[model samples]
Target chain A: MNAIQIRTMAKDFILKEFLPGERPENLTDSTELITDGILDSLATLKLVAYLEKSCGIEIAPDELVPENLNSITQIANFVQSKQAST
Target chain B: MTVAALHEYLEQSARRYPQRCAAVEASSGRQITYGELDALSDQVRDHLRRIGVRPADRVGICLPKSIASLAVLFGILKVGAAYVPVDSLAPPARNAFIFNDCGVRAIFVEASRAETLRCELARLAAEPCLLPLDWSDGPSPLATYLARVEADGLAVDESARPGPDNLAYVLYTSGSTGQPKGVMLTHRNGSSYVDWCSDILAPDENDRFSSHAPFHFDLSILDIFVPLKHGATVFLIGEELGKNPTRMASVIAERRLTVWYSTPSVLTLLVEHGRLDARDDHALRFILFAGEVFPVKHLRRLKAVVPRARYLNLYGPTETNVCTYYEIPQTIAEDRSAPFPIGRACSHVKARVIDANGRDVPRGQEGELAISGAPVMLGYWNMPERTSAAFHVDSSGRWYRTGDVVIEGDGGVYTFRGRRDRMVKRRGYRIELGEIETALYRHPAISEVAAIARSEESGVSIKVFYASRDGHALSLIELKRFCAHNLPAYMAPDWFSHQQLLPKTSTDKIDYQHLMRME
Candidate 1:
């Protein structure tokens, strides 16, 4: 999938799974997910599992840091990099 | 074996291994040697006694985690006074309640918090003398106070020496009635568990332990005392790094921590956010967890990361100080759905699942878990009625009712089912649902209220559903603000829902399960 498609898919998955009660309008493309407490430790793992299963991308241990998975845009970029490198 | 007095352990260890580093504050990298810990604690004890601190009296320690805090703790025990720890992060009102309820005569606070301590003391009905410790600044007010005392030739009283039965510390836990209840633990109550830890973890002078849990929490006892007893080094993780998983993993790697103990929530955070598995360092050998259930999936994943590290799940409330433990198997089957067993009882403790009649339940049946052990707390501090209600006496001995439901498994093992009361462990804090409800009830507009813990795969957070009184319209923001004023940040409900009428059962009692499902 393209970068835009990846971002859209990741954002939709996050809204549906990690933040079911959150409003889509309240979240920006760069809104911090981990630091803002939107995705706690458990939710972060669930999101990782979702990305690996749906997007067919393997998240390395180093990539699990907040800089990579902190926001929808960050996650999309990380996924795009992983996809391109693979 | 009867151990020496708790403070004497530090003295003895200092004599045994004076050159070994005793502790390190992670932020500043300041280290305390065993010899300094012994001598400094003696100095603090003399200072405390000079200030009329008598045996059996309560002394409050209200400083951030540092060398001074540890010295004050050992000094309190040295003088035979029960040290009451109040988390500086908690609201002043909560700290005030603990100080008042425990009737502390004096408190040791950080220099930065001297004014806040003064204000809190002023609000109390009785005043507690404040002794400030300056870790950053030189010649603080506390240093001046000590110098003045010395110059005046004030003689220290060396009369009191605490024995096993003497109160070591009183940790305050969340109470259902909105007031915090102090769990009075004696020196014996702690040493009993420390002795067991000595055998289980088997640390030596070479070992370095990571102190992650906050002082107010019971898990801290293991982090602080266990290492001191063995003449090992303790790496103190500050609150900021303790909450952040990436920093936590980095510290463990840098310090080469051999023994790691914390709540499963912290481990889950490190495993996910920090990718704690990525570290190739091999210092960690023992991984101990308590305070909440470790999700099997996370445990399995962590096991994969540190395959050589031995994993153990310890089970008990603050009252019993860990009477049962389960060593996680090397591999958990992918098809297994049940939570791992809580394993067998710890040394010197008896654990059983009993029915309503206090008799052991049949195999595979669910019942309340009761612990009878030497490590059982003396009782709730100054609250006889609550203490009596928490324990049951029979021909055997006093059994502390855990209020936890467990199902018996084969080979004398038990699997945790759930708690029988409103108490729930969220973010590793044992919070009472009634406590949150009481906080919400303090809001004048709240009429009917119910609080429930919502658990997801990651962790648990509380949600409260409430209705305003007649003709009162209460907004969620206003209610949250009210709760913030009365409750600790962790005790405040994460989500709030407004309702015209709270759902009730046929008997007209609030249906908590229904409320839990509502969110």
Candidate 2:
């Protein structure tokens, strides 16, 4: 899947799992996803799991951060980076 | 004055907020006013009275997070009896040891945990278990009991109540020592700790704190009671956080919560996936955590949004309530390192790093962390020898040894390194492998079980090595998930490994050394 597709999937997962009430159809304002308390620290695991299975990219425990997980867009970029590194 | 009393905090809250909301379920929207809480507690005491429960008796409160659970806790204390909170979320074996070790007279259980509790109760050497939950249409059994108790209007015999020196509750054994050992605490122990901690928190009557952690975990000490004591409202988060984070975030914002306390593992859920920052209402004023080390990266992310909120690191085991605390410096989150310092001891609690010979080590020298103060538990229940060994005494009885390795840096700052024993802290829950296995042995699964702490998060969790009886089959996930239902969430093993044969050590013991080898 391309970055757009990955971002779309990530957004859908977050909306379904976390932001069920605020189903923001668009991830254009990526910051909106996190700043609103729609996701949290435990969601880190789900994001990591999704990235690995969807993009076949492995994320080290140390590499975990909000930058790589702020929104679907950033997580997709992270998968791209990890894929490139391997 | 006895440490066993739970009435002090309750009476204080009742007096302060006779009509103000004291507790609210964030998801269910159920509410409990302070006056109602007081009345409910009276009902709990009355119910216990009907059961022939008396002073210093232990009552096993096996239930989930709700107003009823909180009422039972206070009710037990009101009668000078210590309430043993059992997390219905953990494995049956763990809960069994807790109920049995404490010699619990009666256990108040819900239908959800009826099977697990019934199974464990059957194995208990001898103790009558009562299902307090009533599925009847009229009134909740707990509520009915409380109402009858309230009708008696039994103003607890204040003069007869135990004082500061008495045992408030016995935090039962977890992890290794196989059978759970009760960590004896006093009314004074908890009150003193909460007194100092409350002043530090300065919760106003209007602030809504989250009671998301399990009642069994020590974290519940603060989450369930502190706010009520100060007339601050407490909001109970639905158990939904386990499977969903987005719902949790909505609850946090909707409730207008001011203070939150939970393990870093729970927080990681909100920040990493819930995308909590986008909310308009940021009522959160403080974040207090213990149970496990908070990852620096996560801390940095938390600070980015709630930059002004005070984030604190509370350290200690169930035995010592909380021995040390660190007020997170806003800047340190960004300029951090691995294995961050656990911080200095709390007021009234003293810390001394001691060497192998039990002598005080020099500053910055790593030694077993020995804490002596009001918060240190009286001793382990039923094991005078183990108690004596755990609580060391000198020519003068001045110090208590905390089996933790630490470096007492200059100016009394202490840095936590690792454990001095095989004990581990996962997600802030202490696990002694011996404790989990003790519970496992009760199961008719046939063969053996070994619980180990593989990671910090895997604290108190076991990797069972067992051979099931004919027609018995358990998958790793199913076994672990089963364990989760029986044991407290933290006490439950994270990963399960089944082997055809058990590994043996040179001494002919089941080789825990080989089992600990990372899978």
Candidate 3:
């Protein structure tokens, strides 16, 4: 999948799994997930697992910091870079 | 023959093992020797004395788990003052409540949190002096600040060491009334447990213990003080590594941590997500769990992975540090369905299973557990009425009501049933929410479970919220069927919801208030 498709799929998974009751339309691509408490440590792990399984990418231990998983946009970019490197 | 005060023990340890490492930062590998810890604490103590922190005054240690934070704690104790721990990672409102409630004269905060804490402190009625413990990203580090203090030739005042009766620290616990209550623990209360652990656990200078629980929680008492009392090393796990299973397992393997203490939920995380089974070659000797019930299945799984380590279940509330403890037998792995007992009382503690009328319940009967001993807290701070209500004095002795219902079995063993307040009436039947929670936990897919009673216009119904195991998705129908087979018809949860994570209090217990807010 392309970067935009990856971002869309990530957003869907986040809304469905992490933010259960939050409205999908209200969450923008740049919405803060880690800092804003939408995604906690446990949710961040779930998101990483989902991204690796669905997008067929690998997330390194050091890459799990907030900088890479703070937003859907950042996550999409990270996935794109990892896929390209492969 | 007598025991020294907490700070005095540190001084003695420093004298005996001056070059031995006292603490290490797990992530950064920062080490603090006993001599360095003692000297650094003296500097902070001098600073505290200069700022008018007097005897019995409550000082707040709001910094994260680091070498600097440990120094700040000992520094407060050196001044004959009790240190109140405010979890820097917790919400500001909660920290503000503790600062104002305890009437802390000073708060040692990290430089990164100084601005936010200063803003929050301004709103409080009591104005506490702010002491920067260390700089996370700021200009001056704590070591530099201490060196400057020494260079300025500031005279260290005479120590006013607190006695056993004097308060050591006031740990605030989550209250049901929307505010937290501070449990005042004296040096005697803490030393009782530390002394018992020193003799029983026999931690030597070579052992390395992991401080998994936060300083605010009582479980940390064993982690921080017991090792310090015996001149052993302690490894402080930061927030990130505490939750990361892979990182935690690797740290355990790399550091060769000998003793481990944490809640069962944390252990379950390491068991499921962490490659603990693969990283079996380590020095892990004792796996201690408390604060909540451990699922038998999960405990069995963990025991299988760490076959050489001894599994211990400690039971107590915040009022008393571990009153009863049970060492799990090697045979428990085979019979996972057997009920785990909290075991007999400790050396300095007396436990009684009494009913509503303050009479002892016969063996094989359920009653509320009450503990009375030196380990029991003096009382709640600043809340005399609540304190009197919590502790009852009878002809035998004074007892602190644990609020936990338990069955008294043979050999003075007590098996936890549920909390007395957790029982709710529904459709003319009294149902314990913990039972339903235990039933839901038996489901293979359910990793975490919490049940609450919601009374709506229709009627009172039990609502359940759970998180599925890693890489598993659970359906409501399947959960209901599992519950129906395990529990009675009325005991089944009326509603179920899937959550990524349950909100937790600063002590890492499930925040029922936040769960109630979800509805």
User: Which candidate number has the best lDDT?
Assistant: 1
TM-score of chain A of each: 0.91, 0.79, 0.95
Report the lDDT tens digits of candidate 3 across residue range B1-519.
Answer: 235467877888998999999999897888999998888888788888887999899999887788888888888998889999966866565577789899999988776777777777678766798877566434225576667556563436655667898999998875545466799999889888888877667789889999987787788888888888788999999767787887888888889999998877788878887878897687988999886667787888888888888888988887898999999998675656755888888888999989887898888999999999899999999999999888878999999998889998888888987777876545323456876786677788878888898755334577888888783446443554466455544455666788888779999999998999896
> Against the true two-chain complex, what DockQ does each candidate achieve?
0.07, 0.03, 0.22
Tell me the TM-score of each prediction against the true structure. Answer: 0.84, 0.78, 0.83
Between candidates 1 and 2, the one scoring higher on DockQ is 1
Candidate 3 CAPRI-style tier = incorrect
Q: Which wins on TM-score, candidate 1 or candidate 3?
A: 1
Model 3 has fnat of: 0.09
Report, to 2 decimal places, the DockQ of model 1.
Answer: 0.07
Give the per-residue lDDT of model 2 (tens digit) for B1-519: 223355766677788779999888665577888888887777677667767888888888887677777777888887778888866655666677778878888888875667767776787665565745653523345676444435555545442277778777877656455656678888777877877777788887888898887776787788876887788888886454533556677777887788989887677667766667777577788988887888777777777866768898888888787888888886864456564567888886877788877787888778988888877888888888877888667764556677888888766878888887877776666777675676556666646667666544312344656656653445433353345444454455544555565688888888877877846
Q: What TM-score does model 2 achieve against the real structure?
A: 0.78
lDDT of 1 by residue, B307-335 (tens): 88899999889998888899988888998
Clashing residue pairs found in predicted model 1: none
Write out the backbone clash pairs for model 3.
Answer: none
Model 1 TM: 0.84
Best prediction by TM-score: 1
Task: Judge candidate 2 at residue A7 and give its lDDT.
Answer: 74
